[model samples]
Target: MNKNVAIIWGGYSSEIVVSEKSMNGIYSFLDKNRYNVYKVKIDKKGWTAEIEGKEYIVDKNDFSIFFGSAKIEIDFAYITIHGTPGEDGRLQGYFDMLNIPYSSCDWMASALTFNKFVCNNFLKNFGLNVAKSVYLSKDSKYDINAIAEALKFPIFIKPNTGGSSFATTKVKGIDKMQEAIDFAFSEASDVIIESFISGREVTCGCYKTSDHEVVFPITEVITKNEFFDYNAKYMGEVEEITPADLSEEKTLEIQQLTSKIYDLVGAKGIIRADFIISDNTPYLLEVNTTPGMTTTSFIPQQVKAAGLSMTDVLTEIIECEYQKIQKSL
Candidate 1:
């Protein structure tokens, strides 16, 4: 019997666009012969399922859809939502209460990784290399000069809990610091200002199952812009090189570090970790609990570089998570 899988997408964030693209990518990668897939959109509008050409309201109580004389129950949720309710653990908690298996980290892990400042600081205690950063809550007050003196000039200001690099800004002086912070705060309640590390930008993806631990090849990001901003990420302004041209030692170290972070964060499904290789040391940038799944996304590119199929990877994730749920039951 084929399980009905809901490829959940859309979130109350600017990253919804990326989430939609990821949802479509997952839909295409899923093995149709093994499972019945459906598109479930969860946005400000509400939870709804998209059928052939119509949208059906989803019953939030049971996470089901009622069509013409048929009640389609979702046996699993392949969450691709990039931010907010989905990536921040709200959706995960809801699915947990329903005892529905999902294809991402649990509520706690999702929440932990979603907050850049909190997660990085937490990981830093474990001796992980992370750039010096300052956290700013919406209501918190701090002197801009103090921040500049502490972290120095040329800093990166970004939303503390947002994804897709929306409203992220690179500031080189005090003149633009306030403006950058405001830009970032527009997307999130909190903001983070960190000392920028000049180095090659790279990201590595990893996932673990009862069977094996898979760490895809690292991809070096070369952005034509100042940094890998929104345009560089989705507007084809960046060059991505899979199996990043790094030394053997550096590559292994990065892969091992990524795998370690996954276990430390108690991540599930697929997660991607970004880093800045400065002075031959890889500094942790942030952990993506729910990475993008678009065909051109880093994960897919890395998977292909590792000589693996996306269909197989998706199946492995679903089966492993479903089996865990079955055991718990």
Candidate 2:
């Protein structure tokens, strides 16, 4: 019997467009013979499932039935939402309560990684090299001048719980620091001001299964903007070099660190780690619990470098989740 898979996309996020793109990319690659596919979109109207290529709105409170129609059953959920409800653990928590198997990290990991302030501190406590940063809450009172004094010039101000580099600003001098912080605060309740690290930006992805953990080739991201901002990431404005021009020793070191992080976080399925290389030393930037699935995304690029097609990689993730479910039962 073929399993019913629901691919969830779109949500209350800044990366809504990017999520839609990922959904289309995934919808085109999934193996039809192995599963019954259904597309679900989450928007202001709530979650709606596509049946026979026609959308039927679902009740946000109870996801079992389509409005007043008959109940709909799904064996698994594939989340492609890029931010907010998708990456911040809200959707995962909902699925957990329903006892539905889904791809990507669990609730705890998702929640932790979604907030950069929390994740960076968590990793730092584990002896991981991370850039120093100061967190500001929505209701907290802080001295902006004091913060600037502490971090000095050339700091990165960003929303603490945002993705795709949304609401991120690179402040070079003191004059622009407040403006950058204000910009980030406009998008999120919390913000982070991190000490800027001048170095090469790179990323590594890993696939974890019951048998083993496989690390992919590292990719060096070159962006023309001040940094890899939202435009550079999804708009095809940046250049990504797979198997980044690095020595074998440096590559192996990064791969080792990537695998170690996956184990440290107890991450299942697929995860990507972003890093900044300064003076030939790699510093952990952030960990993506649900990495992008677009054809041009880093994960897909690394997948191709591993001699595996996007379909093959995605299928393996689904099958791995299925096997885990079977074992639990």
Candidate 3:
């Protein structure tokens, strides 16, 4: 019997487009012979499941869809929502209450990694290299001069809890700091500002199960813009090099670091960690628990470079989580 699986997407954030792309990619990769897959779109409008061009509302009480006289329940959820309820742990909490198996970190881990400044600082205590940064909340009073002196110029201002580089800015001087900060705050209630680290930008993906651990190859990112912003990420304004041009030792170092971070954060399936290699040290940029899965996204790129099938990787995630749930019961 095939279990019903839901590929959830369409978040309440600017990253909704990215989420939709990921959902499509997963739908193509999942083994139809093994599981009955459905596309579940969760947006501000409502929760809906699209089946054969028809939309059915999902029952919040049980997370199910009624088709005619049949009620289909979701056995597993492959969440691709990039922000808000999905990536920040709100959805995870809801699923947890229903004993639902999901393909991502738990609520605690998701919440921790979603907050850029706090997650980096938390890992810094374990001797990880991260750029110097300042954090601000909606109610906090910030002195522009004090911030400029503390972090210097050529800094990055971005929403502390959002992704897809929406409302992120690279402020080259103090003249643009306030404006950049305001732009970032428009996207999130909190903001994070960090001193710029100039070097090669690379990202590595990793996932672990009770049986084995897999770390995909690194990808070197090149962009003409000031940083890898929204345009470079989705508008095709950048070049990506798989199996990044690095020596064996450096490659091993990054892969090992990625795996270590996975354990440190108690991460679950399919997380990607980005870094900036400066002065021969990899500085932690940010950890993405729910990484993009579009055909051209970094995770899919890395997976292909490793000569592995996305189908098999996703199967491992589903089976592993399912087994864990069964054992707990």
Candidate 4:
């Protein structure tokens, strides 16, 4: 019997476009021979399943779709939603209550990694190198000059709970601190300010299969823009080199740290970590529990560089969850 899979995408966030794009690529690569897949879209309007040019409202009660009198039961949920309920543990919690397996970290891991400040601090306490930063909420007031003085110039102000650099700003002086904070707060109530680190920006990805727990090749991100912002990441404004030009020793070190962070965070399906290598030390930026699955995204490119196919990557993710479901029964 073919397992019914719901490739969940679309969310109420600035990254909705990213989610849609990545999900389209994922839908194409999912093994159609062994599984029946449905495109599940969720946004401010409602949850829907668009199949065969006809749209059917999804039954949130069971997360299933109905075609006239027939109901499509989802055996596994491949969550590709990038923000909010998708990345912040809300969707994972819902699936847990329904006893439906998913292809991402558990609720706790999702929640922890979704908040950048908390995740960075947690990893720092674990002896991982992290940049110095300050946390703020919309309800709290901080002296602008004090924040500037603490972090120094050329600081990064970003929403503490969002992704795809929706409201991230770089401030080179005290005059820009408030503007940056407001920009970040517009996206989320909480924001973070971090001292700038001048170094090579890179990222690494990892996933757990039925047998292999692997880390893909590291990629160096060099951007024409100020930093690796939304444009650099999605609009092809940056150059990404796989198998980053580093010594064999440097590559092994980052790879080891990547796998260490993955296991420490209790990530299940696929996780990618961004970092700034300062003088050969990898400082953690953020860990993505729901890394983008689009064909052009970093994970896919890294997979290819590591001599792995997208088919193998996606199958391992889906089948890994399927096996866990079997074990639970």
Candidate 5:
């Protein structure tokens, strides 16, 4: 019997477009002969599963969709939603309650990684290199120049729990710090402030199969549009060099660090680690639980470079999570 799969996309954030693209890439490679795949779009409007150009209501109780005359059950979810209720752990918790398997980290891991400040600091606690940062909430008091004096000039201000570099600003001077912080706050209630790490920007993708972990080749990101901001990541404003132009030593070091962090965070499925190599040390920026599966995304590029099959990768993720649920039962 073919298991029913739901590819969840269209989050309630600016990254909705990216998530939708991710679904498009992942949907085609899900091995249609092995499973019945349904596309689910979740936005501020509602959650609707599209079947044969028809919209159906998805039952929140059991994560099932009403297709025409019958109720369709979802055995697994391939979550690609990039922000808020999706990547921030709300959807994972819902799936956990329903005992439905999903391809990604658990609710706790998802929540922790989504918050950039907390995740970076947590990784730093394990002796990993991470940039110095200041965390702020909606009600917290802060001094603009004081922050500049502490972290020095040229800092990154971004939403604490956001992705795709949405509403992220590279404040090059102390004078623009307040404006950047306010802009980030517009997208999220909390914000993460970090001192700029002047070094090469690189990222690597990794995922666990049934028996062992697989880490893809690293990619170096060089952007002309300030930092690797929204335009640089998505709109072709940057150059991403695969194999990272690094020696074997640095590459292995980074890959090992990424795998180590995955275990420490109890991460599952596919995760990508972004880094800044300063003085030959890889400083962890943040871990992406629901990494973009789009063609232009880093993971897909890395996978292709490694000559790995996307179908196999997605299948392993689906099967591995399913087996975990089975083991628990």
Candidate 6:
């Protein structure tokens, strides 16, 4: 019998609209005969599933079925939400408590990668080159000048745990440093101040299955704006070139680094690592445990370059988790 797959999207995050677009793309490519697919939207009203031309609302607090008389049980949940509840550990924790198998990284990996500061530190201990950064908490003393002195000018200030570059700022000098920190702090309790790495922005994605791990081709991002911020990322303000115009040797090095990161972080399913190639060396920027799945997102572009369709990618992720669960039983 075919498995029941729930593609969850549209969460209470800044990337909610983008999540909707991703869900549409996943739904279009999913093989209907091999699996029963449903789209679940999480909004102010809570989780609601749309299947077989009918809608069923789920309880907001407990996630129990509410609307339809016939209940629905999901064999696996394909998470497509871009930030917050989806990308962070919250939703994954929920599924963990209910013993539900979902695609992407588990709770610890999701939580670790969600916070830029924590993930960078974790990887740094593993011998990876991460940018120098300082973390600021809400209760900490405000020392903008001290931080600037340590990290130097042209620093990147962003919420330590947020995604899609929401409320991220580039402070060119000491004069505008405070404003940037305040802006980032407003969105999150912890803020990360990192020294800027001026180089080509490239991303590499990796897929882990039951048998092996595969790294996709690298993609270079050229943004017209100051950096790949919110607008540049989702609004097509940036140019993405696949098979990143790098020498074959450099490309292989980056792919190897990405594979190492995936193993180091104990990342399962699909994950994307963003990097900055500076001085012929790749510096780890951050990792996306739950990357954007929009048609134009970097992962999809790289997957296409690998000669694999998005459907094939998503199906593999689903089946990998399904097989793992069956083995445990």
Q: lDDT tens digits, residues 131-197, model 4?
A: 8899999788689888777878899999999999889998898887888899999988899999999
On lDDT, the stronger of 2 and 4 is 4
Off by over 4 Å in 4: none
RMSD of each: 0.7, 1.7, 0.8, 1.0, 1.0, 1.8
Off by over 4 Å in 2: 59-62, 65-70
Error of model 2, residue 114, in angstroms: 0.8
Q: Write the per-residue lDDT of candidate 6 for residues 1-329, one digit (tens) a residue.
A: 88878898987766787889888877876888888888998876667887667778875455545545766667888898877788887889898777667987888888889889999999999888899999989888867778888898889999898878887999899888888888988778799999999998899999888787789999999997999988898788989999899999999999998999898888888899999999998999999887887778888899999999988888888888887777776
Q: How well is each residue in 6-122 modelled by candidate 3, as lDDT tens digits?
A: 999998888898999899999999999999999999999999999999999899999999887899999999999999989999999999999989999999999999999999999
lDDT of 1 at 216: 93
lDDT of all predictions, in order shown? Answer: 0.95, 0.85, 0.94, 0.90, 0.91, 0.85
Off by over 4 Å in 1: none
Total clashes in model 5, counting residue pairs 3 or more apart in sequence or in different chains: 0
TM-score of 6: 0.94
The TM-score values for the models, in the order shown, are 0.99, 0.95, 0.99, 0.98, 0.98, 0.94
Return the clash pairs for model 5, or none. Answer: none
Q: Cα lDDT for residue 170, model 2? A: 88
For model 6, where is the 10-residue window of minimal lDDT?
59-68
Better of 1 and 6 by TM-score: 1
Q: For model 5, state the Cα shift of residue 63 in Å.
A: 0.9
Question: For model 3, what is the alpha-carbon lDDT of residue 189?
Answer: 94
Residue 116, candidate 1: alpha-carbon lDDT: 93
